[model samples]
Target: MSKLKIGLIGANGRMGKAIIQVLAQSQKSSLSSATVKAGSVYIGFDSGIHSGIKETGVIFDSDLVAACKGSDVLIDFSSHTGFSENLSIAVAEKKPIVIGTTGLTEAEKMEIQTASTQIPIVFSPNMSVGVNLLFKLTEIAAKVLQEDFDVEVLDIHHRHKKDAPSGTAQHLKEVLLRAFDRKEENVIYGRHGMYPERDPKEIAIHTMRAGEVIGDHTVFFLSPEERIEISHKAQDRKTFAVGAVKAAEFLSDKSKGLYNMFDVLGI
Candidate 1:
């Protein structure tokens, strides 16, 4: 197979740089276009140099269409900001895309769903292979332990990270809900002053932001007799970066639809 050309959105951000470095080392892919947010310092510069790799002549631009026009797939790490416009451009250009953005509103998520009918989209909140495995495991555990144990989710990330509760935590909550046939009302976000005794139907979620920790998540299943904990710790951003590139490869030349990490790893 010929090398796949990949375009990157938010190519000046931390995740963007990591993806670029991973692609630089990968044998099956190469950067075709790199787009930064408007007025970025990296604009007009070689994306390779900004990503700490040798120059590859892919200049960082602000035009999303121009970027997508030059590639077979686009990997987006640029959170919700400017996402709608980028998605529109990708759809108009009929290019496959891998979206790793988090903290999207319900309406934005609906937009992705609508666009998926027109273009192939690999949409995932957490792209780490281990984390996706945790998702599957969490579902299995939830199914087996249904209604017998109280469940809770806890997540910690770098202070610089935005989005409370974290996307991975939310995904885990969804898994538990689906496995147990519960509803969104069952989720309780971080306990605070003067709350009543925990309800059996509630799945409590807690989030912490401190230091430079990459990411850590723990799911607790507590019973009167004992406790079971399942956790995944991300030591670095490279895990996510590498998985996203692999997702791009998985999405290449595929049919139009919305796919998740499960589709990529076949879990």
Candidate 2:
């Protein structure tokens, strides 16, 4: 069987390089093309060499559509702005995409949803298997604990990360809200000067960005006598890259629709 051809966006980025390294070793897929931003230093260079590996003869291109021309699927870890444009390009090319970009607005998310009707898309905030399982465990805990415990979410990331509260943190909020049957407005971002006592109807989320922390998330379920903490700490970027590669492999043979890590992992 032919290897699944993969075109990668953000090819010179940390996650992109990580994915390329994994794909290089995988017997199931091949790196067909790689794309970086226009005028990038790595443009026109061999994708593998740019990613700190031996040359693979796949030159880094500037045009996303051109890079994805013959791919079975495209994996994206680019910025929100870059993805917004590439989303249209992917749709135009009728290519499947696994998107790992975060911090998208509600409207931008809607755009992805709309496009999924026409193509296969596996969109995830954190694509680490452990993190996805953490999501499941958090949901199970929320269901059992119910209203008896006050829920708080804490997320930490590297200083260079662009978004606050992290997409994984926000996704945890969604999972809790679903398990509790609560609405969006019921979540509290954080506390500041002079506020009333904690609201039982709300869950609090706190975010921290500091020195080179890959990613860490903790969900605290606090009660009168005890506190139970469910946490997942990412030691490095390979976990996410591997999960995304798995997502790409899963989506390669699927029909048009929207999917997530749950669909990929069958949890």
Best candidate per lDDT, number? 2
lDDT of every predicted structure (CA atoms): 0.91, 0.92
Q: Which 10-residue span in candidate 2 carries the lowest summed lDDT? A: 61-70
Cα error, residue 61 of model 2, in Å, equals: 0.9
Candidate 1 lowest-lDDT run of ten: 190-199
Flag regions of model 2 displaced more than 4 Å: none
Clashing pairs for predicted structure model 2, backbone only: none
Kindly list the per-residue Cα lDDT of model 2 for residues 116-173, writing each as its tens digit.
9999999999999999999999999999999999999999999998898899999999
Cα RMSD, each candidate:
1.1, 1.1
What TM-score does model 2 achieve against the real structure? Answer: 0.97
